[model samples]
Target chain A: MAFLEVASITKQFGNQLVLDQLDFSLEKKQILAVLGRSGCGKTTLLKILAGLVSPDRGSVRVEGQPIQERPLPERGVLYLYQEALLFPHLTVEENLGYGLKVRKQPKPQIALQTERMLYDLELSAHARQLPSQLSGGQRQRVALGRALLVQPRLLLLDEPFGALDPETRSNMQLFFKKIAQQYQITAIFVTHDLKEAVNMGQQWALMEKGQLTHYQQLKDFSKDPKTGLQQEIAFWKKIDHQL
Target chain B: MKSSNLLSIGLVGGFLLAILFLAVGSLATEWRFPALLPERYTFEHWEAWFQKKAWMYYLVLSLLLSAAVSITAVCLGLMTASGLSRDKRSFLWLRLSYLPYGLSPVLYAYSMQFFYHISGLAGTWLGVYLAQLILVYPFAVVLFFTYFDSSMHHLEDQAGSLGASRAVVFQSITLPILRRPVQTILIQLFLVSWFDYGITSVIGSGQLKTLTLIVYQYIGESNLIYSSLASCILMAPPMILWLLQPSRSTKQDIPV
Candidate 1:
């Protein structure tokens, strides 16, 4: 059995069906990039997995144990939004230590772990600054470090880099990859950018109308017309030929 | 001076001049219309009122009533606004919150007087309080509703996901974030209750003699000195609130 199993998840908002019999599974330490356009239930899927929204009908298992009925924090799933929602009142050190503080960790452990996270995020120089004082990339790094310090079983990222400029986005993506590797994080990265899905994910899936199609290989994802990879390659090739 | 600077000085000068006029009016022995200052100034009115202790009585009563109304309204309003922010029927509820303000306060009090009379609350301090609350509670709700927006809810969710319990989230995140807005709304609602006349007159039934009602009494009797004294006293709390308010640069934010 896979490390995480999600089966027959369905959700509806009013008369509109948002998720229709979604099914997928992930191995330990694998990153699944879910590619979809706007209004394709990508956010809903992540929210469901994170236990923020209840699935109308579904079962989710993490490490052979059911988690859908569990309370949000107990579910060990953290969902990151497009914005870097650092607690505005908190300093960088305090924000990084928030997860540990909430868990009622001993003060010494919290200080040690928070220091480590601040160092890892390269934010020690600005530890006393509030969120408003930080740059966009710095804030997002703080947010990511805060989440990683919690050591959640799964991280659900919903277009986390969508608000960043292209240069910042590329840097964040690389930084995320480095951290995910260093920490062996299991994540489902959701994005509308096909290239992001191809580059960031070890496993791949495409979602349309609440239905998800899993791709077992890179070539399979590339060949799938729904992913727009062929069109992307052709366009890049034309630009290359012109140049 | 620049026109803008002149305008600012003019406004402050005008306000101070008005307060001085009231102070002189409260102390005048006899002042004719043409006189710039009082013909003869005396402390008799202030002395006589202090001896009777009537001013103290009304001052304490008004303070207690407005404090109770404002504190209760702010607490209840915060909870109601938080719930309403997530509710689908929020627009309808917010619309209803504005309904009480649509009518004149006196007319609104008259409309609700029957319920107070039947409940045996009319002509009591409680009746006047409930009456003012009818006006101020909804005002508080409307003011606080905008403070609980999508971003605020998102932060609460983020806190919950970070393993903070509901109580922890409220204590650590919600209350701290709401501190400034709560303070502002508390002062606003207090002033609303402090200066209320129409509703208090109708529901208090001449029995609840708050400072505002006493000031109106002096005015009705054409006792200008006592009226001025009471009016000056009535203005003190709000003026203090204004003076105590933080400057814009130093003011802490509330809503995310």
Candidate 2:
């Protein structure tokens, strides 16, 4: 059985249906990138998985246990947003250490882990700075560090690098992949960018108007005409030739 | 001059005029209608006002009442706003929350007189406090509702996902984020209650004397010197608070 199972999730707002009988599953340490246009229920799906929103009907199961009714802490899920959203009141070090502090980890361990994360993210010098003091990329790095320190069962990224410039976005994407692989973190990242989805996810899915279509491999995702990945690749190639 | 410059000058000019009036009114020993200026000035009224032990009591009473009402109103408002912002169904009640603020405080106090009488709260400190709270807490509610926007909800969700209990989320995330706005709102509510005359008189039934009531009484009795002295005393706290407030540029640093 899949390690994380999302079964028949349905959500509606007023007369409009946002998610319709959505079902999917992921194995241990697998990253599933979901690509969708705006208002395609991508955020709604992530919220449901994070337990921020309750589905109209359906359930989520992890390791054969139902987590749909469980509170947030018990679910062990973290959702990272496009905005860095570092707590303005906290320093970079404190923001990174937040989850550990909340989990009541030993002070020394928390300090050691946070310090290591600061160094790894190249934010050691700016550890004492507030969120407002940091550049957009640095803030996002701190947010990622915060999520990782908690050792969540699953990490959900909702276009986490969308706000960054191209260079910063590329750097963050590579850094994310490296850390996720090293830690063997199970994740589902949502993005509108086709290249980002192909680069990050082992399994891919396309969401359109609340329905999800799963692709087993990158080859299938790129080859599928309905997804327009092939056409997109050709357009980029044409630009490359002109350049 | 730019409109902003004009507005600033107007505000400063108004404040200076008020101060000038207070000084002239308090110091003048006698003034005939034919003169623009007072004929004679004396410090005796100020000295006499300061020497009166009862004036101190009135000042202390006003301070305590305003502080209590503002703090209580802010706490209650924060709770109400948090609940209302989180639940879509509760938003319908937000319009109703403004009803108390829409009515004049004296009228609202009059309407509550029957309830206060039955509860034996009429003419009591508790009665006056409740009356001010009804008038001011809604403003706090409205302010907090606007402060705690949709973006704030994301922070709450993020905290919860990080294994924080609800209380932990509030203390660690929400409260800290809200501190500046809360402080601003608290001072505003305090000033609202501090300057109040009608609600206090109506609710306290002219029994509980505050600095405002004293100022009103002196003004009505044509005790202009005493009234101006009391007015000076009454205006001091809010002036200090305004001076101490964060500057406009720094205000943008606050999230909401």
Candidate 3:
């Protein structure tokens, strides 16, 4: 059985269909990148999977257990937004410790883990700084550290790096890849950038009009003409010939 | 920058001058026209006022009423705004909240008095509290509405997904995010209830005597010293509230 399975998820907001009969599955410790344009219902799918929103029809099972009916905290799923939504009032250390604190973990254990995360995020020197005091890249790192500290069963990322500059985004992508491998994180990464999907995810998919098409291999994703990879490559080749 | 600094200093100077005038007027026995200062400054008025002890009772009553009204209004407003902000009909509901402000407080109180009378709450402390709440609750809701934007909602959802339960999210995320706004609204609403006389007089029907009512009564009786004393008393709590306000720099990053 798959580690996470979503079947026939359908949602509508009045006359507008936001998500329609969406289906996907993820194996343990595998990252699935879903590429889509804005208004393609990628966010809605992530929200539903995170249990932040309810679907009119579908079931989500994590580890063979139905999580659709579970409360947000009990579902063991964490959703990260495009912006680094850190608690402005909390210091870096405090934000990193928030999840464990809410879980009623021991104070010493929280302190120990939060300290470790701060070091891992390379934000130990900024342990006392508020979110507003940090740079964009630093803030995003803290956000990721906070989510990972909770050790959620599934992580839903909704274009978390989309707000950063290109250089920072590239660095963050590498950072995420490193941490994801180290922690064996099972996650669904949603983004609009096709190159990002190919770089960041082992499994790839494309979403359009609330419908999803999955590709099991990089070659398959590249071969899919709808991806426009051929056109981009041909344009680059023509430029190379002109040069 | 320089002009703004001078303006701030001028405002503070004006406030201090007003307080000094009130303090001197409260103590003066007789001060004729054109006198720069009172000829005879005595503690006679203060002694008499303290001895009568009526002001103490009115002071406590005013404190209790304002505290109850502001606290209840803020709590209700926060909850209502949270739910209303996410609703499709939020704009309509918020527009309705402003209806009370269209009618003057006195007129609104008089209009609402019938229900109080029929419910047997008129002329009681509860009656006055409820009347002030009616005027203040909607104002609180309007003030708090801006704080519940999409980003705030996203923060709450993120907190929830981070293994915080609803209660935990409220305590940890929502309340902290709302701290500055809540403080601002609480103080503003408290002052609204504190200095209120129109709604109280109309609703209480001369049975309840808040500090504002007593100050007006002293003025009507042509008792300048007593009125000045009452005015000074009335301004004390709000001044203390001002002093207790959090520093501007400390709240620089209050989350929307």
Candidate 4:
């Protein structure tokens, strides 16, 4: 059985069918990158998996148990938005320590874990600084640390690197892969950038009009700029037109 | 820390000036230069009311009722705001709900009396409270909706991913972040409720009389000393809360 099972989940917003019994199953500690154009409900799917939204039909199961009656936090699902969602009132240390604080972990363990996360993410010195004081890369690192601090089984990333420039984006992407490796956490990252989808995960799923139309191993997909991803590129172009 | 901020502070001073001018004619009863200060500092008039045995209870009841109304209204407002924040359009409904504040308090109170009376709430603590709730709930909703809507979108999601139950998320994410706004709303609702004579006079007339209504009674009787002393006494609780407030971190936040 898959560690996380999303079986034919259906969601609708008014008369529009946002998701039509979308079925997806994934292994534990594996990375799945969801690639889709704007308004295709990639974010919405992640939200459903995170238990942030109640689906109109179908169900999600974790570890083979139905999650119908469960709340999002109990499912150990974390979502990272495209923009950093750090609390403006908190310092970087406190922002990263928030999940730890919520779990009511002892102060010392929080300190040790935060220190290690800061070091791993190269955010040690800026611990006392506020989020407004950090650069884009630093802010994203703090966000990652916050997600990892809880030791969540699933981390739902919603295009968290969207705000960074190319240089920072690539750097944060590599850093994300490293943390994902170190923690061996399951991550479902949503992005429209094809390069990000390919680079961040072993598997890639294509979403269109709130439906999952394609799924593949990243290595199986070709990356040649001239001919590669032509179908996806064209599919997104049409979707953009519709949007 | 902007020029607009300085302008707002200047406006608070201007409000105090307006209040002072409201009573300037009392000073005109005797000659006073510039008519800014009262003709004579006479405490015996309003102070005599304070000296009465029953007067303090009005102050006590007003404080208790307003505080309760502020807290209950805030919780209700928070629920509505958090629920409504999921959609962008729900804000229009929330904003439109504030039409009560735009109406004359006396008319609103009289109109609402039937609802309270039929429910067996009038002349009862809960009745008077619900009356104030109706009048002030919009303010609570407006204040907390602004505070919670923008920030809470991602908050509950994050909390849930951490093994927190729905109740846990509500407790952990919604409540902590709410401290600052709750403190602010508490003071504002208290001030609004404490000074509100229309609803008080209607719902709490004999069952309870707040310092505000009593002060108004003396002012109508042309009893300046009684009105002034009662007004001063009535203003004390909110004044103390405002003063004791900022030292607490939650009370000191800039609206941003």
DockQ of each: 0.54, 0.62, 0.63, 0.36
Residue-level lDDT of model 3, residues B26-145, one tens digit each, is 999987678888888899888988998778999999999999999999999998998899888999999998999899999989888899899988899999999999899999999888
The true-versus-predicted C-alpha distance at residue B240 of model 4, in Å, is 4.4
Clashing pairs in 3: none
**TM-score-superior candidate, 1 or 4:** 1
TM-score of 1: 0.94
The docking quality of candidate 1, as DockQ, is: 0.54
Q: Write the per-residue lDDT of candidate 1 for residues B57-167, one digit (tens) a residue.
A: 889999999999999999888888888988989989989989887899999999998999999999998888888887889999999898778788888888888999978
C-alpha lDDT values of all predictions: 0.89, 0.88, 0.90, 0.77
Give residue B26's lDDT in candidate 2 (0 to 100).
Answer: 84
Model 1 spans > 4 angstroms off: A238-243, B1-3, B34-36, B249-256
Number of clashing pairs per prediction, in order: 0, 0, 0, 6
Error of 3 at B225 (Å): 1.9
Best by lDDT: 3
Misplaced by over 4 Å in model 2 are: A233-243, B1-7, B249-256
Give a tens-digit lDDT track for model 2, residues A34-55.
Answer: 9998899999999999998899
Give a tens-digit lDDT track for model 4, residues A54-133: 89988888889987687565677788887777766678898888888877899999999989888988888999997878
lDDT score of model 3?
Answer: 0.90
Instruction: Give the alpha carbon lDDT tens digit for every residue of B161-254 in model 2.
Output: 9888989998998887787788888888999999998889887988899998988999999887888888889888898888876554122243
Whole-structure CA lDDT of model 4 = 0.77
lDDT of 4 by residue, B125-226 (tens): 788888888888887777767765545767666656765566767776677667777777777887888888888788764666778888789899977545
What lDDT would candidate 2 get against the real structure? 0.88
